[model samples]
Target: MIDFWLAAGLLLLVALSFLLIPVLRSRRAQLEEDRTALNVALYQERVAELQTQQEEGVLDAAQMDAGRAEAARELLADTEGVAAPRVTRLGKPAPLLAAILVPVLGLGLYLHFGASDKVELTREFSQAPKSMEEMTQRLERAVAAQPDSAEALYFLGRTYMTQDRPADAAKIFERTVNLAGRQPELLGQWAQAQYFADGKKWSDKVQALTDEALKADPKEVTSLGLLGIAAFEAERYQDAIDYWNRLLEQLPADDKSRIALQGGITRATEKLVASGGQVVKAPVAKATALLKVSVDLAPDLKAKVQPGDSVFIFARATNGPPAPLAAKRLTVADLPATVELSDADAMMPQLKLSNFPEVQLVARISRAGKPTAGEWIGRSQPLASSTTAPQTLTIDSPDK
Candidate 1:
C-alpha cells in the first residue's frame, strides 16, 4: 500500500507539472518584458536630457541628433536577444486554479471508481491467513469488491458454512446460484446450507434444490451426503445407509473422506440393527478384479481437442453387452492420468469387473461432454480383467 500510494503520488506530480510548468514560464517571460520596458524608459530619459541641453545652447543640432542615435543604440544593446512577451487568453489565476483542481478531481474520481479495495484484498490473500476469522474477513472484502464474481461468492458461502453461520451461508449460496447458474454442486451446497439455516429442518425449497441437483448428476457427492445427513437426523437409519452407500460408490478408494463416511454408515447400520430392522448386505465378489490404466491424448490428436473436453475410460466384456462394466470420467486436462477401475466403480450394481473374464479397455475424448459418443477413441485388445500389470491407453484413432 505504501508503494501503491507512492506511485500514485508520483503520477499526480507528473500531472501537476503540465499545469505548473506553463505558469512558471509565463512568469519568467513577464520579468523579461518588464526589463525591456525599463531599458526603453531609460533611453527616453537620456534623449530628453540631451534635447534639453541642445535647447539651452549647450549642444548643436548635430550633437543632439548624434546623442539621440547613441541612446537608441544603447537601448537596442540592452534589449538584445529578449523575446516578445507571450500572449495568454487565460491569466495566471486560471492555471493555478487548474493545478489545484486537477489533483483534487483526479483523487475524487479514483476514490469513487478505482480498485484500491481489490488491490488490498489481493495483497492480503498473498499470505496465508492467520486465522479463520481473518480468512472470512478477506473473503467478505473480496465479495464486496466483486459482487458479480460467482467464484468469490461460492468460496465465501463455504467459509460461512465452516464458521457455522448457516443463515449467512444460505444467503451467500443463493446469490452464488443466481450468478453462476444452477450447477449441480452449487445447488447441493445451497440446499445443505438452507436446510441448516432453517434450524435443521428441511423445507420444500431444500428438497427441490437437492432433487434438481441429483437429477442432473445422480452421483453428485454433496447432494448424496446432505440427503444421508437429513435421513439420519430424521431417525430413518435405513434411508441414511442407502444414501451413504450411493455416495460411497461415487468416491475413489483412496479418498480421504472415505473413512469418515464409512464411520457414518456404520453408525447408521448399528442404529438400524438396534431398532430390529434387518440390514441386507450388498453382494460382494469373492475376488475383486482391478484394472489400472494410464490414459493420454495422442500427440497427433492433441490439436483437435480442448482441455475441458470430457474423457471417459471404461472396460466392457469383449463378448458381452456394449455397456461398460466399470468406468471413470475425467477431463482432457486430467489426461495422462492413471485410474484404477474395480467393482467399486461399476456403472450398475449388477455389473462388476470380477464377473467378466475377458474385457476390452476403451478411452474416448468427447467435446460434447458425452461418454458414449466422441470424436477420438482408443481401445486395448482383449485382456484378462484380473491382469495385474498396468496398461497404457492412448486416444489416437477416430471414433467409429
Candidate 2:
C-alpha cells in the first residue's frame, strides 16, 4: 500500500508538471517583456536629451542624427536576447487552479472508486501471516473488500470455526453457500457451524443441510463426519458408528484423520454393545459410479492450442444446476489420454454423478484456466449416469 501511494504521488507530480510548466514559462516571458519596456523608456529619455541639444544649437544636424542613432543602438543592445512575450489566453489563475485541483480531485475520485483496500489485501496475502488471528483478519478484510467473493467468505468462515467462534462461522458460511451455490462441502460446513453455534443441539435447519448434502454426494466427507458427531452427542451409538464408518471410507488410507475416525467408530461400537445391543458390522459399500473418458484435441485445433493450456473434462447433470457433477483437470499436453470421473472426483457430494440420473460429458480447452469458459469445447448427448461404457470426447468447436 505504501508503494502504491508513492507511485500515485509520482504520477500526480507528472500531471501537475503539465499544468504548471506553461505557467512558469509565461512568468519568464512576462519578465522579458518588462525588460523590453524599460529599455524603450531609456531610449526615449536619450532621444529627448539629443533633441533639446539640437534645438538649443548645442549640436549640428549630423551630430543630432548621430546621437539619436547611437541612442537607438544602445536601446537595441539593452534589449538583446529578450524573448517574445507570449499571449496566454488561460492567464495565470487557470493553470494554478488546475494544478491544485488535479491532485485533489484525483484523490477524491480514487477514494470513491479505487480498489486500494483490495490491493492491500492482495499484498498482505502474498506473505505468510504471523498467526491465525492475522490470517483471519486478512480474510475478513478481503471479504469486506470483495463482498461478492464466495471464496473469501468461505476461508473466513473456516477461520472462524478454527477460532471456536461458531456463531460467526455459521453466518459467514451461510453467506458463502448463498454466493457459491449450496455446494455439498459448503452445506456441510454451514451445518456444522450452525450445529455448534446452537450449542450442539440438533435443529431442523442443520438436519436439512446435512440431508441435502448427503443426497447430492453420499461420500461427502464433511457431512458424514458431522452427522457422526451429532449422533454420538445424542447417544445414538450405532448411528454414530454407521456415520463414522462411512466417513472413514471416504478418507485416504494414509490420512491422519483416518486413525481418529476409526477410533471414534470403535468407541461408538463399544458403547452400543455395552448398552445390551448387538453390534452390526456394516457391509462395505459397492463400487462408486465411475465414468471413463478418452480426451483428445481435434486436428484442426491442435495448432491453435498451447501444450500448457488447461483442459477440463467433466460430467454435469442434464437437469440440475450448471455445476459439474464430476470433473478432471489436465494440461493439453496430457490429451489423447484416458481419465476417470466418479464420486471420488465429485465437486459437491449432492451434485455427484451417482446422484444424477442423466448427465452430459464435456471437454474444454481453456487458456485462462477457468472451467466454465474456454477457447474450444466438445459436448456429448445426455446419457445414463450408470452407463458402463467408456466415453470419448474431443475439443473440436470454438467455445461460444
Strongest candidate by TM-score: 2
Off by over 4 Å in 1: 281-400
Against the reference, the lDDT scores of all candidates come to 0.92, 0.90
Tens digits of per-residue lDDT, candidate 1, 230-310, equal 999999998898899989977877789989999999999999999999777666535479999999988988888888999
Query: Which residue pairs in candidate 1 have backbone atoms (N, alpha carbon, C) closer than 3 angstroms, thus clashing?
Result: none
RMSD of each: 11.0, 9.9
Top model by lDDT, which number?
1
Instruction: Give the CA lDDT, 0 to 100, for residue 179 in model 2.
Output: 92
Candidate 1 residue-wise lDDT at 261: 97
Q: Per-prediction TM-score, please? A: 0.71, 0.71
